[model samples]
Target: MLVALIALITTVLYFVGGALLMQRLKLTAAGEPPGSRGLPRLFTLWGAAIVLHAFVLYAFLFGENADSLGVFTVVSLTAWVIAAFLFAWSFRHPIHVLGIVLLPFAGVTVALDMALSGVGPATPMDPSLRAHTLLALIAFSLFTIAAIQAAVLAIQTHMLQNHRPGGLIRALPPLSLMDTLLFHIIGWGFIFLTAALATGLFVLEDIFAQHLLQKVVFALIAWVMFAVLLFGRFQFGWRGRKAAHWTLAGFVWLFIAYIGSRMILARLLGV
Candidate 1:
């Protein structure tokens, strides 16, 4: 019953989010205000969907008893809050393009939260450990979403650079601004990834034991890739195609660290 309920809400949010995004894209392409007639209503509806989705997961954690779900619940809540604030800020910064693109992705996450449910205390582990884990995961989540946005931005940037026309390219922000936003997001992500690794190490002793190693290794690899990317960007003036490729590579490692660790922890190691 709980699983189905959460899934239903998850699907609703995904569908609504897609509609809102498509509407926004259409408005932008038309050279009209992104906030057009009925658009505010759609945004408001999305807000409600977000709140509803959060509550459903919270219930899944508090009402039922699943540690893994609770871990996911806390992370999802954090993502919700961040996405909300970022979505609002996108108005001035225009970084919201990434946010809208990423919103529907959350639905996949929420569904996974339901599918991966197992028997345990909804609230798991010591408070300190929980805090570290959730913080790390949430940080990775934002950057992961941001990475996807950067990919789109890069494609848009490329098309404009080459004087290509049509498709979604016409609606995106200019190349310079996209590059600026890309760096901004990656810088923050690197910091968070570092802190996540540090805190994760502190939270768990013996890095090789249990699920720690996989998360740690992939996380470290992600951090290294970004570090190299940033270094190349600053030192060698690596921009455009190189930047996009490097960004995608870094995110690949991050995905493994995020979803991969969860699976190994939940299924393989039984952590």
Candidate 2:
């Protein structure tokens, strides 16, 4: 009961934060700087909500008799990590443009986690497996941020290219900064993903034999796509729309590799 209450409160805060961001963006015209006055209070609310959410999640995931890690738990944890990172990074970087979309999505995931609970089998808490899982979650969180950055970059590019920069573009970081952030995010995500894959292949060798071959294959593909993007960024000076498109494309493969494959194996195939 307490857990549900916390989740509900967190969900409300996330939605409210997202709505506030959207309104703030809407209020800023194409040529005007984004409003910053309301951000401190908003960040405080998010910090409080995330702290509660993290506490609830830690209790649920590591409680007595919590031997199995379920799909819903994984999804919830992934979103939680992303939200936590976003909140922390907001202090150093002006990446709040992502909150307009990410916060509401986080709210939805929290609600779903509370409502549906877990539908799939839970994996036992093996130490090596836990390490692998942590790496995977961290990698996914980084990639998720990169994906959001890519999306915003795409929008910013289009608005500038078409000279239709009256709404969102005004509120976004400059294009060069957005592009730089995207690559840096992708670079870090790639490193984490590489570690995740290494751990999966070496520590969790049985996963491939146990119906996760598709996930591994797609993950490799996503890794390769990111590699190419990074190489192009450094070697060929890729930027603007091209970089955005490739970043999104790499994210697509990753989405398929992780979440899509999980949905198939657990929900559809019932394996």
lDDT of each: 0.68, 0.84
Worst 10 residues of 1 by lDDT: 116-125
Query: 1-271 in candidate 1: lDDT tens per residue?
Result: 8657856776577667766777777776777755446656666766776776767666765674534444455455656655565666565775555646567766765665666555322334577776786667666765765677668867786677788754466556677777777787788778877787777766777766544577778878888999999899889988777888888888888878766666556666566
Clashing residue pairs in candidate 2 are none
Instruction: Give each model's clash number.
Output: 1, 0
Clashing pairs in 1: 66-122
lDDT of 2: 0.84
Could you tell me every candidate's TM-score relative to the true structure?
Answer: 0.82, 0.95
User: In candidate 2, what are the lDDT values of residues 1-271, reduced to their tens digit?
Assistant: 8889989999999899898887778778634554678898789878887887787678668876377787777888888889888888888888886888888888888888778666775667788888988988899899999988888888889889998876777777788888888888889899999999998877755765677888899999999999999999999999988888888888898988878888788877787
